[model samples]
Target: MIVLGVESSCDETGLALYDTQHGLLSHALYSQVAMHEEYGGVVPELASRDHIRRAIPLLQQALADAKLAPQDIDAIAYTQGPGLAGALLVGSSVACSLGLALDKPVLGIHHLEGHLLSPLLAKEPPEFPFIALLVSGGHTQLMRVDGVGQYTLLGETLDDAAGEAFDKSAKLLGLGYPGGPAISRLAEFGDPLAYKLPRPMLHSKDFNFSFSGLKTAVLTVVKNHEEKVIANICEQDKANIARGFVDAIVDVLTAKCVNALKHTGLKRLVIAGGVGANSQLRASLNEAAAKKRFKVYYPELEFCTDNGAMIAFAGAMRLQINPDAAQRDYSFNVRPRWPLDEIKVV
Candidate 1:
């Protein structure tokens, strides 16, 4: 079956064509990072409008690049929830309309599920019953995955998401918007011990995490720097601060993941979401995995963020489980919020 997936969950507009036989044929993504950069964060209204403008052309380009027509697409899969309402509406409306016009099945896929299953799209895919660490801009979570559509929430953030903390704190430091990468780069030169930021909930027996305190800790560091009590932070100090912040986050994340593994007895770990792109986090996790001798899997960098290939693959998997779910004569509603465990596939 051929599935066309559309993703407009946040600041990204992605379209992709996936064929079960040949794999992902073509995919396109347009990031609104630059548009939101000046605003220091995403503006919902602008993000929605941009998605409206980019979806169609991107879909057309994806289909053309795949050397197929709309009719060739067997189903349309769109991220249905847990994102900006307007942005989700754009993709949902377009996907449903296209599905109706083409007489193809339309599946409303959960955004987090798309992120969770992304690693499977890579050359090295983890087997069933693995733990997934989903650290994105809006969410930071740990889950036990028995299989597609079978996810058990292990733990999650009680306050700010990891990526959100990164971006917001970076802004406070004048690192600009979408600061994860920039801050991460600067962190490479810094000493993790220089700043000694707090690692919130690192010792929590449960899987739950808390980054709010960590954000406050960053604020305190910056505040002290401004008062001249600590003097102007040198380039090395800035780097060291970055390193400490990143390290604190990574430490908490790693601890929770390790705990989740022990709790679930799952030896394999799959990391997903935008923060999975962090070089430091990846290195830290990789080193831990090596010492623990536990396998770890990561999606290709492009798939690490919101994209359509995972949606397409997920839609394809759902359809394979129940072919009857492929009827698309009528429109379907998009879900802005849904629980991963509530979904049961085959």
Candidate 2:
């Protein structure tokens, strides 16, 4: 089956064509990071407008890359929620309109589910009944995955997900927007022992996570550095603080993931979402996996963020499992706050 996926959940406008027989045929993504960078964060209005401008051209590019006509697509899938409402509407409307035009089936996919299932797109995918860590800018969750749509929530952030903490702390250190990458890069020059930061709830009996306290700790450090403003802080201090913050987050995350795995007795660990792209986190997980004699899986870097490919791949997988999952209903609604575990299998 040929499925076209549209993703406009937030700052990215993505389109892709996925062939069940051939895997991902083609995918295109247009990021609004450059535009949003000027504002130090995303403006929903601007994000929505950019999606309007980029989605169609991206779709055409994806189709052209795949060498497929619109009519050749068997189904249309779109991220239905857990994003900006206006942005979600753009993708959903486009997808539904396309489905109507082609008389093809349409499916509304949960955004988080797309990220959770993205690892299957990797060359060496984890099998069923694995542990999954979905860490991104908007969310941080650990789940026990028995199979597609069979997810048991292990735990999630109480407040401020890991990615948010990273960005917030980076801003405190004078880093610009989308602070995760900037902080990670700066941490490379940092001395691991330069400062000690708190690891919030690292020893909690449950698998739950909390990064809010850690971010606050970073703020306290910045204040005590004798700098009246971020500009007054020296570069070395920034790198050192970034390292401390990164280490603390990595430690807590790694500990919780290990605890979740041991609790579930699942050896296969799958990391998805943007924070899963962190080099330090990957290194920590890799070392732990080797020591624990388990396996770890990740999506290709391109699939780490919001993308149409994961949505399309997820939709295709759903249809493969239950052909009746997709309907001819062109009418659709988006859930800007959908929960992953609420998704019921058809």
Candidate 3:
């Protein structure tokens, strides 16, 4: 089956074509990061408008790259929600319209489910009944994934997610927007012992996570630095603080993941979402996996963020498992706040 996926959940617009027999054919993504950088965060109105401008052209490019026409697409899949309503609408409307035009089946996929299943796109995919750590900008969660749509929520953040903590702490250190990468990069120059930060909920006897306190700790540190004339803060200071923040987060995340694995007795661990791309986190997890004699899996870097390829791949998986999951009806609605546990096998 040939499935075309559209992803406009937030600041990025993505389009891709996936062939069940051939894997991902072609994919294109246009990030609104540069545009949103000026505002220090995403402005939903601007994001929605950019998606409108980029979606069609990206779709065209993806099709051209795949050497196929629009009619060749047998099905259309779009992220139906758990994102900006406007952004979700852009992808949903476009996908349903395409399905209607081609008289093909259309499926509405949960955004988080797309991320959760993305690791299957990797060269060495994890088998069923694995643990998934989904750490994204808007969400941080651990799930016991038995198979497609068979996700049992292990735990999630009570407040700010790990990615949000990274971004918020980066901003406190005078870093620009999309702070996860910036903070991670700056931490490379930091002395691990230069500062110490709190690791919230690290020992909480549960799979749940909490980063809000960690972010607040960063704020307190930044305020102390500002008290001594912000200009007096040196580059090394920023790096040190970044390192402290990163270490704290990594520790909490790693501990929780290990705890979850032990609790579930699952050896295969899959990390998905943008924060899963963090080098520090990966290193920590890899070392732990080796020491624990378990395996770790990750999506290709390209699939780490919000992208159409994951959406298409997820949709294809759903269709493969239950062909009736796809509907001929073009009407659709998006869920900007859908929960992953709510997803069920068709």
Candidate ranking (lDDT, best to worst): 2, 3, 1
Model 1 lDDT tens row, 119-210: 98898788998999999888899998888778888888888999988987787667898898888998999887788999998887898888
**Considering TM-score, where higher is better, how would the candidates rank from best to worst?**
2, 3, 1
Alpha-carbon shift of residue 309 in model 1 (angstroms):
1.0
- Clashes counted in candidate 1 amount to 1
Per-candidate local distance difference test: 0.87, 0.93, 0.93
Local error of candidate 3 at residue 225 (angstroms): 2.4
lDDT of 3 by residue, 1-346 (tens): 9999999999999999999999999999999999999999999999999999999999999999999998899888999989999999999999999888889999999989999999999998999999999998899999999889999998999999999899998888889899999999999999999889998988888888888999999888877875565456799998999999999999988998899999988899999999999999999999999999889999999999999999999999999989889899998888999999998875
After TM-score superposition, what is the CA distance of residue 175 in candidate 1 from its true location, in Å?
Answer: 0.5
- Runs off by more than 4 Å, candidate 3: none
Q: In model 2, where do residues sit more than 4 Å from their true spots?
A: none
Model 3 residue 164 distance off true place after TM-score fit, in angstroms: 0.6
In model 2, the Cα lDDT at residue 341 comes to 89
Q: Give the Å error, residue 52, model 3.
A: 0.5
lDDT of 2 by residue, 156-267 (tens): 9999999999899998888999999999999999999999999999999998899999999999988887866879988998999999999999999888989988998889
